[model samples]
Target: MTAPDPAGEAAAALGADRALRAAARHSAGRLTALSVSSVAAAGAALAEPALLGHTLDLLLRQDPAGARWTGWCAAVIAAEVLLDAATARLTGGVDARSTARLRRLGLGRLLRTAPHHAARHSPGELSARLTTHATAAGGVPAAAVSAAVALLPPLGGLVALFLVDVWTALAFLAGLPLLAILLRTFARASGASVSRYQEVQLAMAGRLVEVLAGARTIAAAGTAEREQARVLERLPELGAEGRRTWRIYGATMARTSALMPLLLYVVLGVGGIRLAAGALGVGGLLAAVRYAGLAAGVGAVTGRLAAVVRGRSAARRTAVLFGLPELAQGDARLPEDGPGTLELRGVRVVRAGTVLLHDIDLRVPGGTTAAVVGRSGSGKTTLAAVAGRLTACDGGRVLLDGVPLEDLSAEELRREVGHAFERPALFGEDVAAAIAFGGGPPPGAPAVRAAARAAGADDFVRRLPRGYGTALRDAPVSGGELQRLGLARAFCRAGRLLVLDDAMSSLDTLTAREVERALLRDVRPGTRLVIAHRVSSAARADLVVWLDAGRVRATGTHTELWRDPAYRAVFGDAADPDREAAGRARAEPSSRPDPGAVLPSVPEPPGREAVR
Candidate 1:
């Protein structure tokens, strides 16, 4: 399946407010523990300063209470400072474990998604989500809980002030509405900008990966400058967005700064006049000012809360990244460990409205060799593919040892049948490893040497710096050499069915003939299917099957087909001029052979393919 739309992914990450809440719940126990300590610390911190103010006020008037208040103030200050440090440490530890659990769940979901889901997204984009997004989301518990914790002490202080003087509490309450407006404006506006910045960060990561991967292509095309320009252009846009977020945050903070001091001035100025006029005591005025200072920390908490909301946006994006799955549903059935006879029953392959192979009913009976012959486009390769089950047939069943191919698991089929194509692809591993790649060396040196010798690669491989042990990077091997190694790997597989899909096409005719002879001489007596262009190679097989326009036009020994006009028409008249002369050389009898022996008595056309 193609990837779900990017918009859906973006929407999911952005809309996972529920996931964020769920994560919070997971962290709740820890958060509560930390909050308890944090609130206690905050109360201690507030108490010491209040006591200090009391001690100073008493000292100024030389009251006897001054001596008692001084000792209490000194002791309380030390305990409050120690508790605040301890709570901060506790909060840090709890957040670490919560982030780790969230990471595991998100990553596990992604691993379950299908392979096509992975193919649709870039490695860079996925990495960005895991790294950048996960990092942001991981802080959710601490930020949300810390804001609440920080707000508590100030709230408690405000209540104390309310009890001391109603007019001072009223003055502080007046600033609350304006302060709220500023924080709301900052959070709303900056939320969008921070989200934008997070997106750009992901894009930048993706772009960096792309640039590194395509460095060679970019250099060859002289496109480095253009790519640099594109990156440069995007950077400023991100920078500008970041600036906007900062300004909004700063604006919110500015209002809190202005309001805190204004409340203090209004309370002190009014309370001083009231005290002088005998409406309140000097001690009460001092306490009211100290409480007002404690309330000011609310602004910092509000700013942190806003940043946390934005960080969570990143976390949600990363979680979606971890949700994508890789790969498809593979076949699950197993092979019976019996005859690996491969058969294509009335199969036709069609592509782009053109028939590639039609009604190709061919079989490689167990412990037999069969060859498919045709022109370049006459379906020789396609017939070989059907027998190997590399490409699926559009019509009819391909059976392995009488079992339908699809019913057998892919691993089972591969285990039973192996193929060597005209072109072979090797991984970035070294030469010796690629040769042994179909699996490890075939149990012993004899098996590995025989397989390599059969492919005519053992000689050249031995001449390399370290022979079979040579690293691929240390020596240069041509494509033809790689093809030989691929064949060696296929031979080493030792499956019941071996398929050579024009595998010898890369070698010269002499070398190809040498390899062919060695293959027949050494490979196990398994059912073999050879797709060949040269008639001589096809003639070596026990049965020769000819494909023309996706159909089996002829099937017989080479000499028998030489006399048939349809076969003659396709391959041209035998150039030997003397049928007897060629017959004597081949030592094949000049009598009509049993047709049913080599092929299933030429399939009739009325059903699917018309026998000529």
Candidate 2:
């Protein structure tokens, strides 16, 4: 037999303790009841074999009390059955309750964490952690209780054997060390394999989720087979780990299956010899044989240990989600009713050692619109994210209405700043609900309709089967229509600061222009930060902030920057020789504000170009 491993045993003990603590925290009463019932059931079961032996012996001797012994044996058997049933019921309840608590806690933490931080884990991995891992962790309490109960039969068997014949009991105990070594080996070996298997499983699941989300892109690229291969690339690793775990378990069971029965036969042989020598009576011999079987059935304990190891492995994954750091919030609240004057002071953001934005200092005055324009990768989106506090800057600060953004509570921030994304996650129950989903109180029907009209979305929405009451999933709205609904939702809440991150990308030129005009006319007067890709969008803004390579290249009205060749190149002109002539003709300096200029009426000169 192999020597005992103190380190392995210690780790197993620690894992069991952690599982127990989690269970106790979530389902203390249920766990306690389960443990109690399981113990009682095991105790009653342990007494049955001995009582049967005694009853049989009494019948053989033709004793008058043999009938009473038989009756007592029957009573013990019935009690064991009832106790076992209660144990099963309590065990399931405890597992379910603990699993639910873990899932809830994990999901809550995920939702509250910052988007960039939450992005560290993929959607598939997070889903698995909440589902598969949670279910496995929930079984920990039941396994612990079952493991405790499994000890009783063997202990009782050993005592009964010793009382019947000392040599038989000694023979039974001689094989126990081998069983212990086998269990420890399997527990240690299978743990690593199981952990690896779960990781690979999540990797594949994450890949699948990404593929499904981008199915249209894959189809357009005509790479369905290639994508399928990419998704299954980790399948071999997963299978290898799964096979390794099963092999270890099977080997342990095989060795135990061989050794435990041998130990039982040895005890039986010893009891038979003692009986022949008249050192033990027939009833005692019978009792010794039954006790030997119970003592050597160590397979039950092996199964329980396997369950414990599985639970511990799953708990580690769940812990990662639960332990994620939630975005911090302050105790202060925004002051009552002020224009949203946004200021960014020396803001910098670095992700994975790549600078997304650097030394950004800008201010958007209340009631004015500022368009952030840049080529793809030029930090426009990052700036919008920082301005909205969707992600906190690595350095410096952003303030709204003279209060640092970090000083405001979550509720205050949400109530004061609103965002509309290019691809909005519209997951409300119905069309109207989707249009009034975030930040502020739900708007009444008139307000919802007005916001939709402002976004140029009312015509299409009213054509849906149930109009406002149509389920969002069943509405089958186009991408542009969906973006409009998201815009309406953002407008309905109408925070002090509104950020549009390419929110109008899907709309046609006419629809976008109408929506922009309506935004200027109908929305509450507040600060606007628009991340623009088109020259038309920049032309509509009161001021334009031009970003190049994570730094602010220039800031002024669009007409002023239009003369710079590089700035014109942002709208895809290499060098416009006539730009200087155009600037001289306008005779408008970049510094002066053109208060009378309304964007839609601004004439685009021939060869000067418009946003394509």
Candidate 3:
């Protein structure tokens, strides 16, 4: 159901006043043409009553030549056709622009959120927001404009009827209160159902996506029947909702359809008798009845319009996806300094009042490697995430190049601080493009191949038919291969902090070792937070952080921490013996390094495995 006089607000709201104001302003010409055509069509309808009355009076008086009446009739038909054709073309243009604006807004907003925000939403739902919802929005302008124009025929004819016989016009006015009540009730009830239906539609679509994605798994488990039943289970509710809507509409129309025809007769009959009795003129009687018919026609036309109203109501429910109050646009400029310093001071992360990490203070000197090793649920990944700024922490700050992470613009942080997730997302792009992903600039063949080789992905890529040009996309790719692709892409930029959040988790031992060595030896010389599970990867780290239960249990050089029982248990015999043995052998106590000042953990850029 639409708001009373919603056409006024709909047109006004859809009019300029957004980023698309320029585009909407440009579209004004086409919209004006559309309005012109609609007016012409309404004019044709209004002219019919006058033409019919004129032709009848002329023939009855025996005053018209046949050609004159015939010509007038032909002109009316031609005007109708021209109006219909022009209206369609102009309205179609408006629909195109409206849909385009909605789509652009949705995509533009998504572009503003954090890098991983898009990954968090279901792809199918995201697609529906842009496509299904957008498609529905297109019809709103057309139907709403049509509805607005529909009002013109009735109102214009009523004006003519009022002049002809004010008595008959009163009869038409008698049904006003009823029609208003009917349409108003329909708009509200149907609008609510429409919003609910769209929510269900999104839920069903998400289910479909899951079913499609896990088709292989479902089939392997012999659970296709079960999954299909799950989808079917929701269908009954949807079917019920559809059937319920149809019933309400069918009932409403049953009453109004009968009421409109009856109302038409009361006006026409009363006016006809008055004309026959010389109380009203013949021309007045004909025009007034015709106007009365046109007034009743609003009921028949708007009855069907209820469906379009419901459909748009469904679309607007999802308007927040794009029609948000604010669009996302980062204003922060890129930090001028390189990835010179990374520090997390007194940082803690909590979820639902349960502390996940506590009082973690850490630092990375520029161009050094530190391996964070801990058991599962030990906050290894969470700590790495803090440096990557993936999740916000409750207390503390993560800084890059001495600037707080939050203050740095998203663009600067991304360009200067590159991170690859363990389960990295490679969008629907080619293998080379995926590898060169967030890498600084568009890469050439030689650069792509060299980076892939360094990440140990070149040999496999060359085996494909198109080599660097081969499309990996979403068709299918091994986990290990995807990991390497993320790795190779990391080499595309330099002078950045490289955070490997279990980056090498999927790779085999030898491949993982090789990739880490390639990164340290040849990739960017930024500080690295190498989150790892295996002890061997930590062996080469200039500094080792042993995490346990979300706290920094120990932080020292690999050799210095070997003899610490807590560190030994997590890293085992892998810690360096010579340095730990001497530290244990030293009778003198050791003092902790200053958090603000140190050699900056800058080791010969020796690194280890990425986060697991």
| Top model number, TM-score | 2
Candidate 2, residue 25: lDDT: 75
For candidate 3, the lDDT comes to 0.71
lDDT of 2 by residue, 303-367 (tens): 88888888888887777765566877786877777767788888999999999998888777766
List candidate 3 segments past 4 Å from native. 1-29, 64-73, 115-121, 279-283, 300-308, 322-339, 346-359, 390-395, 473-476, 562-612
Task: Look at candidate 2 and give me any clashing residue pairs.
Answer: none
TM-score of 2: 0.88
Model 2 residue 283 lDDT score:
81
Where in model 2 is the C-alpha error above 4 Å? 1-20, 61-64, 573-612
Candidate with top lDDT is: 2
CA lDDT of each candidate? Answer: 0.71, 0.81, 0.71
Candidate 2 vs candidate 3, lDDT winner: 2
Better of 1 and 2 by lDDT: 2
TM-score quality measure for candidate 1: 0.61
Using Cα atoms with residue i matched to residue i, what is each candidate's TM-score against the true structure?
0.61, 0.88, 0.82
Residue-level lDDT of model 1, residues 125-175, one tens digit each, is: 777776667667767777777788888767877886787678887877788
Local distance difference test, candidate 2: 0.81
